[model samples]
Each structure stands twice: as C-alpha cells, then as structure tokens.
Target: MTEGVPATAGSTRSTSEKTAIFWLLAGVLIPLMNIVGRYRVRGLENVPEAGPFVVAPNHYSNVDPIVIGIGLWKSGRMPRYFAKASLFRIPIVGAILRKAEQIPVERSGNPRDGAGPLRQAQQIAAAGHAVVIYPEGSLTRDPDGWPMRGKYGAVRTALDAGIPLIPAASWGAHLIMPQSTNRLSLFPRKSVDIVFGEPVDLSEFANRPRDSRVLAEATLKLMTAITALVEGLRNEAAPTQRWNPTEHGQTEIGRFNDKR
Candidate 1:
C-alpha cells in the first residue's frame, strides 16, 4: 500500500495502512478540491485522536460528502461514509467504493431491512474506525439552509457501539454546486467552512431502552449540537423549530423543488 498522509497525533493506524485505491483517489481528489473551494477547518481537536467514533454532520448539498470527507481527512482520520446503496451499484465507482471499504446503506420502508446498514456500521465503529454519517439522511429541505429534522441512525450507531458521537457542520459547499441544480461555479472559489464540535453527551440515554421515544430524543440532541455549530459558522440563528418534510408533504429523499 502507498504511504498516505501522516496519521493524526493520537491515531493508532499508520499512513501505510491506507488502501491503494484510497490514496489514488485522494491524490486526484484532494488537489481538485483545493482548486474548487478554499477550505476553512476548525475544532479538529474535538475529534478523538484514537478510537472508534461516529461523526454526524448536517447535509444540505450534493457535494457535502466530498467536502466533509476532505475535512475529516485533514483532521488525520480516514472517513468511512454510509453511502447510499444505489451508488455501490455503479460501474467503476462501485468497484472503487467497495475496495475503499465504504459502507452501503439500503433505503427501505421496511424497518427490518433498514436496520441492516446500521448494524454493519455499529460493527465497523466497534472495530475502531471513524464512521461519518449524515444524521439528516438526505439534503436539508429547510428553505433557509438550516438543518431539518434528523434521523436516528447516527445516534443509534454511536450508542450501540459505545463510542463517542461527534457533531460536525460544513458551510458553503452549496455555493459550489447549489441545491436543485447540476451547474458548478468554480470561478469565485468559495470558502467551505467545516467545524467539528465536541462529542454529544449521551450519558442520560445510556443503558436506556432504544425505544422510539428515547431514540427520537437522542437524535434531537445530536441534531441540536450540529445546528449550533452551523449557526456559529453562518453567524445567524437557526429557526426555533426544525423543518419537517412530512409536515410539508415533501418526499424525504431526492430533489423536492427546482428552485436554485
């Protein structure tokens, strides 16, 4: 395997343990990312230098995963995403994702079927890997770009694995590729700000039954932390109430509107 960037101070893994495909992708993508956007990363010290942890971030754009991936990479931890299973069926992309060991998430209406990915993610976290899960599940439907209601996967995974759950926020990626549009603006060189917040305190929920009420409360606490981080980056206050797709009769996944 090719030697990658030096591991962060407390990380147990060495640079040489990175997969060849990961390095290859990083070699190409990192430079491209720099050219596309100026990154401003902060609060990396909040990340546990070593151990399995789940980082949940607010999602608002199609390019979020790429930007957040780079941010975590700079923080000295290789990010393993819970990517949509559909992407794992693509030609070359799927092959690379598999080789990179990214987890695949299958979206389904059946609760049993949907639990599979979370179980796999918990196992991965237990084995001491950094897992990045977007608690929102999909891009935010909030009109002002604030985070909407979040799902329970991130909290469940962290609580089950008994690992710290870190809340993260990324701002300005939507300027590169605005929501509801396929166009890209590489000229102005937007500054993408990413901030990692301290691990959410789940002690109150620890050892409690993972019932719907408990999970919902824990998920809200996690999302609240993420929104606060985002508020700091934007220098604006989020709405008192989070946006809910169900209340608005909008689909949870995919593009709901074409307003760019």
Candidate 2:
C-alpha cells in the first residue's frame, strides 16, 4: 500500500440502514428515471452473491455511480466505490461518503500516489465488500462513440487481491449529466440500461509478474469487455455508431491522471 491512506472505519449503521437508503433511493428515483425511458437491465445475476469483487464500469456521468449502486443494491449487493476525493470534500455528501467507506481517489497523474485509494479499495474488496471502480478513470468523448483506454490500477488491484472482476456497462447517463459539467438538465426520460458482465478470471496474474506489459494486457482485456458492453448499449441508443477502435477516436478509459 502507498503511504498515508488509512483504512476507513466501518459504518455504524446496520445493514438495514444501508439497505434502506439504497432501496429508498432506487425505488424513488430509478423508477422516476425509468418512467422517462424504459430501464432494460440484463446480466444482473452476474453480480456475485457474497465475496470480494470488483464492479468495473464505464464512467460517463456522476450519475453512473448512483445508478450502478442502485442496480447492485437491488441485486442484493452494495459496492464501496472509489470516487474523486474532491466529491468527498463536499460538506454533507463528503461526510456521508466517508461514513459509507467510499474510497476517495486523488486525480493527479502519479502512479505511486494514485495507488492510495486503489489500495484502500482493494482492502475493502478483500474484506468481503463489493467495490466499484471506473477503469477508464473519466468519461468518454469519442466522436464515433467508443470506450476509451482504461487505467491499470483497478485491474492490478483486483488481480493482485484475487478478486472477481465484473465488467459493467451503462448508457443514457451522459445525457442526464454530461462530462465536466455540473448543471443537470431534466433528462428526456431515457431508459439507462445498467448491465453486468460475467466475471473475468485473473487468477493467473494473481501470482504472475506485475510488469507493465502484464498489467497493461490485463487492463486492456478488462477494458475491452467493458467497451464491448458499452458499445452494445450505445448501439441500442444509436444504431449507426460502432465502437470499433478505427471508427471511434478513443474509448472512455485512461482519460485522466488518477493520482492523489
């Protein structure tokens, strides 16, 4: 583990409170969002029942995490997500996030430094809690609509810890809240599909070298799966676009310096 990022304290609330907050939010807001557009969920059962697992998804909007959390919670799981540290610095929201044990990631471009939150995330997952990570590290801006290159920290941490890596796909969140913008407009009642992909086994790398090449391959494979899922979902929204690397300028991965 890198220096200075201490492990988070466990929540004082019982599982009931956690479950209640999750369901109440999902039940109230998810349906309201769905009423605007049909929420077509697939591969939900792909989420594990109990165990340390990584929920790696394409990041498009801030709402992506909320929607992802709701979907996971509905499926009898709740993920402690790695979020921007700045978000956790918010007054009430930050306090809540800190209490909820969410990992606060520093987004500067230093690898050794970036590992702080990731290490904490790995600890959380290793302790038998689901953890959500955005491998891409930021939202995508592909003119042709494709997933960007994913960073290596998420994959490395999951593989090193021997945790299940679950790829996730989300659509329509960008419309609700686009990248680098805070103003949330009333969405067009679009159905945002949140799908979970089958777990990718990285046990081979669990003992293998953590070389740059090895880590990059693992990260790429994971990102490819996520990009494929995202492309599929995007195609559902706009059939004309394809996620082919040649067509899309870049995928949503590796779009930021995720250092603390």
Model 2's lDDT to the true fold? Answer: 0.68
Tens digits of lDDT, candidate 1, 37-117: 999999899887677788999988888888888888887788888887899999999999988778987766455765878
TM-score of each: 0.91, 0.78
Candidate 2 residue-wise lDDT, 16-75, digit = tens:
535555554566766656554555678988876666678888876767777787678667
Stretches of model 2 off by over 4 angstroms after superposition = 1-38, 236-260
Error of 1 at 138 (Å): 0.4
Candidate 1 residue runs with Cα over 4 Å from true position: 1-11, 258-260
lDDT of each: 0.82, 0.68
